[model samples]
Every structure is written in C-alpha cells, then in structure tokens.
Target: MYASYKNLKIEVKFQGQHVAKSPYILKGPVYHENCDCPLEDSAAWLREMNCPETITQIQRDLAHFPTVDPEKIAAEIPKRFGQRQSLCHYTLKDNKVYIKTHGEHVGFRIFMDAILLSLTRKVKMPDVEFFVNLGDWPLEKKKSSSHIHPIFSWCGSTDSKDIVMPTYDLTDSVLETMGRVSLDMMSVQANTGPPWESKNSTAVWRGRDSRKERLELVKLSRKHPELIDAAFTNFFFFKHDESLYGPLVKHISFFDFFKHKYQINVDGTVAAYRLPYLLVGDSVVLKQDSIYYEHFYNELQPWKHYIPVKSNLSDLLEKLQWAKDHDEEAKKIAKTGQEFARNNLMGDDIFCYYFKLFQEYASLQVSEPQIREGMKRVEPQTEDDLFPCTCHRKKVTRADLLTHVRTKDEL
Candidate 1:
C-alpha cells in the first residue's frame, strides 16, 4: 500500500490548535447548478482549463507545474479552503475562534496555511479554546463582508470564517493553484516595460462565472466591444448551461495577462483571486468596488495603483475612456500598482502580514470559553473515507522553498 505513495501527510498546526492536517477530501470545481457528475468526470473537465506546463524555466526543468495526482495532493489541504462557513461580525462578546468549513470546498489549503503560518510567529498567543457549532449554523454570511473589513480582520470573508489572511492572491485566493505562481517560483511575470508598449488598448478579463458581476461584465463587453475584451472560462459547465454566459468561453494562457494595456479585475465568489498578479503586470487594473476584501486591500489606493469602478460597474466605460485619453496617467497608475505589488505583496511580505494580523487578533480575545448556545463540534474526514478532489501551492513564508525535501512533510 505504501509502495506508490510519495508525500504522505500535511498536518497544519497554529498556536497548539489543529488548524487542519491532510488526508482530507475536496469537492473539486464542478458546480453545474443542476448536474451531479462523478469525481473523475468533474476532475477531467477541470483539467482542460489547467495550466499543464510551468511558465518559469526552473519549473519546466524540474517538471513541477501540474501535481503527480490532484486528489492525492488535495487530501493534505486543510479544511478552511473551499467550503461555505458561518460568517460573522466578530463582536467582543464572542469568546471562541470558530472555523466551520469543508475541506473539499476550493482553495482550502492556502486558506488554512495563511492562518496557521501567522500563529507560528509567537507562542504567548492564545489558541482556539473551544469549537463552537451552535445547534444551527449562524455564521454563514455577514451583512458587511467587504474586502479586508475592520471586524474580524484575520478571517477570510465575513461570509465565511475562512482565513482572510495575507495571501499574494487574496483576491489572488482562488485559482487552479496546483501549478501556478507560488512563492517558490520567484520570477513573476511582472510588467517590465511600460504600459505604452502593450499591444491591446482595450481592457480584458477571462475567467468563469463564479459571481453575477462576471456575467454582467460579459454583457457589458458584448455591448462595448471596442473598450472591453471579457470572456467566460468554463468549457464543460457552460456547454451544458450557456444561458447566463456570452458566446465566448475561451482558454487564456498565463502570458495572455500581459497582452493588453488595460486589465479588468472583477470579483468572483468573493474578491478576485487574480488581482495581485494583474496589479503586478504592465497593464492598468480596472477594479470594481466589492464588499469582498483581502488582507492588503486597505493599503491599496484608488487612482494610485488602480482605477476604481462602481461595484455595479456602471462607470467602466467612462473609466476606460478617461484612461484612453489620459494615456500618461494610465501608464503611471499601472506602474505604481506594479511597484506596490512587487514591494509589498511579495511572499515574505504576505507571511509577515499574516503573522502581525494573527498576533493582533489573538490579543483581542481575553476571557473564559463562551461557547455558542447551539454550536456542536464536527470532525473532519479524508479522501479515503470520502472521495477527494483538487490541489496545492508553495508556501511563501519559507526561505528555502526551491529545495524539495520530498517527504511526507508540508508541500
């Protein structure tokens, strides 16, 4: 049984509390709203959209882009990544740090690690004293779950008690993260030349229909073809359900992100996970004001790093027109955004933010356990007990990331 195994386990611990260790199941990214396909079927469908080859020379030489097995790697992802959770306001009255999540939901590993990495900084901090699962799940959503909201700053979203910690991809959170840019691959595709040298003048966006805003964007793109170049990214999901999407559902290469002068960044289920990469690129980021946030959103300024659009995207065309007329300013904003991302959003920077955020949050909790009235503890199950699906990425906090120890240790 052990003959074929490579990396055996991934246990994540933070301040003496079991954040999550792996051998856990993941549900994969196959949500068709009205269809229930087999695990292989869903994984096969998702594989079409995957980046099979690594962009960097090192990753290519080492053959490190796609994992040997998605499900196996997914098994080690912590429980905080993908599933839904009870969102909350994080009032001073609440006494426990409750993480009610699904291991299979998407991006669980990165989500968990961000929180776990932070607590490792100091030992005096308090850990999760009690696991609260009220008779009913009450923390599923928040009335004010904006990007990096003031209340419960360490949590991922007010909608989910996920690790809203510092990630290069806070909006960079969700992705086919298995073989994408991690902290280990240092040669990020930053916009080296000026934006004036870019080929495409119009704004572009190529992602899936994770949120209603993306659909609206596709519609806007259709109406204003000259200014927008947006498209849906699902091949199989839209083949069955094309009612909400436009005619185009194309596959975008990683290099394609730098092809244009302007890049449109929109929120998916929450914040757009790919925003940081876009900001780091040569193109100006045309962002939408969303309730969903990330760890560094508070630090980013509008017009300085990116052009802010209405949450409704009502002013996208106007913003584009302004950028086109004011080419110098657009280029400057893009350059500034890239600089900010390079200096502030690096892997080490992200880890430091997580540590500081964790320390600050831990300082606030100072009382006996006040378990919620209805909450009950739920144990986690791995892929063996429940069929697993999905991925893993490199941790940014580590210094010697390129040397793969190749043991059943952390990935």
Candidate 2:
C-alpha cells in the first residue's frame, strides 16, 4: 500500500489475471533523515507536505506591501509600461481565464492556462484578475517614491516591489529555453544523470556572460583547475571581450550538468531559472549570494540545501575546497537538497501555490472583477472535439452557427 524506503512498483491481479491499471507505482512521501514515524502521522505530514504552508508563504511574500488592489494594478500598469509586449492582464472569472495584451504572447498565455487548468482539476479556482510581467527584469520604484504596484513576476530583487510568482518554465518549457526546446522542470529532474558518488569532483558551471561574475568564475577556474571548471558557453553581453573570457564552448544537454559533484549557480538578469533545476539534482549546489530571489528561496537554508558563495564569487574556491575537505557531509547536503526539491517543487505544489495565491489575492479585492472590452477568453484545446478552442485557433461562434443553419434550410 505504501513505499517503505523508496518508490515501489506493485502488480495487481485478480484470480491470476491482471486488473485495470495493474502495475501501480507508489512513491514514498519525503521525510527527515532518520524518520521512523508512522506514514499517517499528522505532524510529519505537515512538516513535509508543504500544502498547508503555501498560503502562509504567499502571505509572507506579500506582507511588506500594502493590501493588493487589483483595480489599481489593472489601471496603473498600462500607463506605466505602455502595454509592453511582455506584459499581460489576466482575469479568472467563473472558472474561465481571460487575457488582454498588446502583443502576441502565445507562450506565456499558454503557460498560465495550463497551470490554471491543472489547478481546476484539483481545487476550485478563485476568481482573480491582475497584471503579470514576463520580462527578465523586475520592476523598480523611484528612489523617493511611495506606491505599491502589485505586478506579478517570475523573479524579483531585494529592492524591487514586484510580487514574485512561480516561474512559467516550471509548467511550460518555452520560457525555459528561450523558445528553443520544450522541457519542463520534471523533465530536467528525470535527466539528471549519475549518483553523487559517480560524478566528477570538480565544480562545474556553463552559462552565458549575462553577469560579470560568471566571467570571473571562468578566471577562477583557470587558477584552481582542480576545484572548479567554469566556462562561458555563450557570450552575448561581452561579445567584444570574448577573447579575454576564453573561447566559447558548445551548448550541452541539461543532463550533462549532473556529471559534476558541485554545481555553481550565479544570477543572469535576475534570479537564474536554472537554480530550481540545479537544486533538484544529486550534486551539491554552490549558489551565489545575490539580491535576486525566486518564490521558494526563503525556504532554502545554506549548509542544508545549498552552499552560499559571495556575490562576486570571492570565496568560491574556499567553498569548493570545503566541500572537498568534507566529502561525506557535502554528499549529505546534496541528498537533503534533492529531497527538499522533490518534496516541494513538484507540479502539484506549483498548482497549490497558484491556487492559494489567487485565493488570498481575490479576498483582498475592493471591486468585483469585470470582463474588460477587447479581452479574449482563453480555453484549452482537444483533438477529439469537433470544435475546440486553442491558443492558436479561434473558437466557432453563435453567429457562425446561425448562418450555417440558414444556409442548410435554404439548400
């Protein structure tokens, strides 16, 4: 009925015949290092499940700001950003999602719809409308300003006021690869290869020159060849200084990152999207200390889930050396981090966070949401249906049905 140590596969049969869905798989709920508590223990469940804490965490993420005013956000965003291409206005009313945007943002729209659909399958989706910015940079207020614009975003810095939401790439892969390939967070976890004992001892990093510290990481690798092996796979921001940064390397599969024992996570434009994927792997993550943070960042504790390095990567070699000096302890940290991610960052958790976030956000609404003019309803598509609404395809209308009926009667 339940997994004792790890995931188990059980085959069910009725009188020597396989039953429907017979080969059922069971996964063990995440537990502490030496937890021998009963499977149905309420305290242990709350400690590991993270479902009950979702609302409290959402409240913590929004506590610094004033009460969220959806009407205020819907009115101020367009005037401030001028209907930017990466900005979208969303409204969830009567279990249907609607959007109003200036540009064709098919990917972000699809990501939002997919998550909402998944959430609706598990719980009643709360009615809420707010603005979201799909850009890499978070919003910054004026130096002496005094206003709270609750614009949702994927990432935010310490000084920013934008409300941080789970990144879209967690559900849809389009944002993960910058529109190149389709691979979600679960896919990344599946591809993380080799156990910790089988990986290379060197700390590994492969990324663009989006941040200057990344370039310095490569230089540090050159000095401490035994400890680190960082390189710029692509050089966009510092293309002119490519010669100084060393030759570019070919892009490798995300699975290749797990080949090393230590993973180096440095920020790009904001909080790097790769950090979540990195945390889920078997290798110990050496994260950079920066102002930018994702939604689940507050829960990550250094020396437990990850090792923290200075923002400028000043103590990277020292941290890597420490990991080498205490190999077993480092491996335990890796396992702890991996278990934490497995328990909290799953698709179900994402849906739970979204549902609770909107639920709390809707409760603070001062005015009932209205479907604004020019807003188009977004619905999921199906191949079996004769008429299905999709992101790329338009839905059949009542006017078209009336015209078809009249033509049939005349014929």
The top-ranked prediction according to lDDT is 2
Estimate the lDDT of model 2: 0.72
For candidate 1, the 10 contiguous residues with the lowest summed lDDT are 129-138
TM-score on alpha carbons, each prediction: 0.54, 0.77
Candidate 1, residues 74-131, lDDT tens digits: the string is 2322233224432221111221233333323324334443334222211122333212
Residue 64 in candidate 2 has what lDDT? 53
With a 3 Å backbone cut-off (N, CA, C), the pairs that clash in candidate 2 are none
Q: Kindly list the per-residue Cα lDDT of model 2 for residues 25-130, writing each as its tens digit.
A: 7674322211222222333433554666545557865675446566676777778873454677888886667888744453566666666654543334567888
**What is every candidate's alpha-carbon RMSD to the true fold?**
17.7, 9.8
The residue-level lDDT of candidate 2 at 360 comes to 70
Candidate 2 regions with alpha-carbon error over 4 angstroms: 1-50, 53-56, 64-66, 83-85, 102-107, 140-146, 173-191, 383-411
